[model samples]
Target: MTSTAATTEATEKWSGQLRANGRRVTKQRLAVLTAVEHLPHAVADDVAAAVRGDLPDISLQSVYVVLADLTEIGLLRKIEPPHSPARYETRVDDNHHHAICTSCGRIEDVDCAVGHAPCLTPENTHGMTIEIADVLYRGTCADCAAQAS
Candidate 1:
């Protein structure tokens, strides 16, 4: 499908999700969702910039608010690496990990190594059941590695 069509479909899907959760769907929310869908692992500022392409008057605060709401509702995932701003993505509903480049701060999705939920087995759960395991692998990306070599 064309990019525009894909965006529209994604927007509709998110809209339905918001309504199903009894949340009001607004243009800013849709724009923020579309931005995160198109640019996975995007920081709040980057999402705001993308949203601004469609909504010139959108404020960064509005983008942050939408992102926080979407994440709280499980429509989006928020990844916050150490020493970095939180990034937003729509690729949730699975036990996936992330690889972050130290040099460029680029982030990419890494599927569960064992292909299952809660991919890692903890030695102890402190008397609590584990449902999800969030792991962040830090290293240089291909481009950065090549450049360094």
Candidate 2:
């Protein structure tokens, strides 16, 4: 498909998502969602930068608000690794996990390690039903390992 057609399709998708989530379809929201969709695992600052390309007057604080709102509505997923700013992604439909590089701090998605939702079972749940799990795997990525070597 053409780039213009692709852009229109994506805009429609984002608009539909916002409306379905009971949100007003505003330009800032659309821009923030577009930014996150283009830059998965992006922090707020990165998202702000990307949004500014299409919205030069948008503020970082506004971006933060949009990000939080999107996350709260389940349109985006926020992941916080230790000592790193929280990152946002559009993949909120599944129970997935992440792997972070210890050296460079690069983050990558890791599928559930085992069976269905909440892949890892705790030894005891204290009678509470578990719905999902957020697992963070830390290791040296290949580039970091290669650089070290």
Candidate 3:
């Protein structure tokens, strides 16, 4: 495995998470993890595209498997802002939110107000388990706003 020290630190946390969730550590997981660490908020296909650069033989199916596995173990966060493909980010602990630019389709991260996991509690639980509460704020980004004005 091509191990970057920074990726290693991130993967260390993820490794603990995988074990806690009863998952195994593998090279595919490393590749997917490394890719997400490099490019947060990446779509599935985008991750596959990136991992392909390092592991040329890695199949798209393999990327999907890694993504699903990591997501299941809570090593990755999957964000599906409305009208967009799901995006993955490796930062799992902060309970951050995203802001999507309507004109440019760009997304940026905003650390949660509470600065911790499950940052906000919903008004109504409806008797469902809640592990996270995310925000997808929509507006024109600065560049788009400038262009309009």
By lDDT, the best candidate is 2
Point out the higher-scoring one by lDDT: 2 or 3.
2
What is the lDDT ranking, best to worst?
2, 1, 3
lDDT measured at residue 131 in model 1 versus the true structure, 0 to 100: 86
List, residue by residue over 1-149, the lDDT tens digit for candidate 1: 99889877887888899999889999988888888988999999999999899999988888888899889998899998999999989999899999999999989899999899899999988998998899999999999999999
Per-residue lDDT over 74-112 for candidate 2, one digit per residue giving the tens place of the 0 to 100 score: 999999999999999999888999999999999999988
Best by TM-score: 2
| Model 1 weakest 10-residue run by lDDT | 6-15
Pairs clashing within candidate 2: none
* TM-score rank order: 2, 1, 3
Q: Report the Cα lDDT for residue 2, model 3.
A: 52
- What shift in Å separates residue 128 of candidate 2 from its native position after superposition? 2.6
Clashing pairs in 1: none
- Over 4 Å off, model 3: 1-20, 128-130
Scored against the true structure, residue 77 in model 2 reaches a CA lDDT of: 97
User: CA lDDT, every prediction?
Assistant: 0.91, 0.94, 0.85
**Candidate 3: lDDT of 27?**
69
**In model 1, where do residues sit more than 4 Å from their true spots?**
none
RMSD of each predicted structure: 1.3, 1.1, 3.1
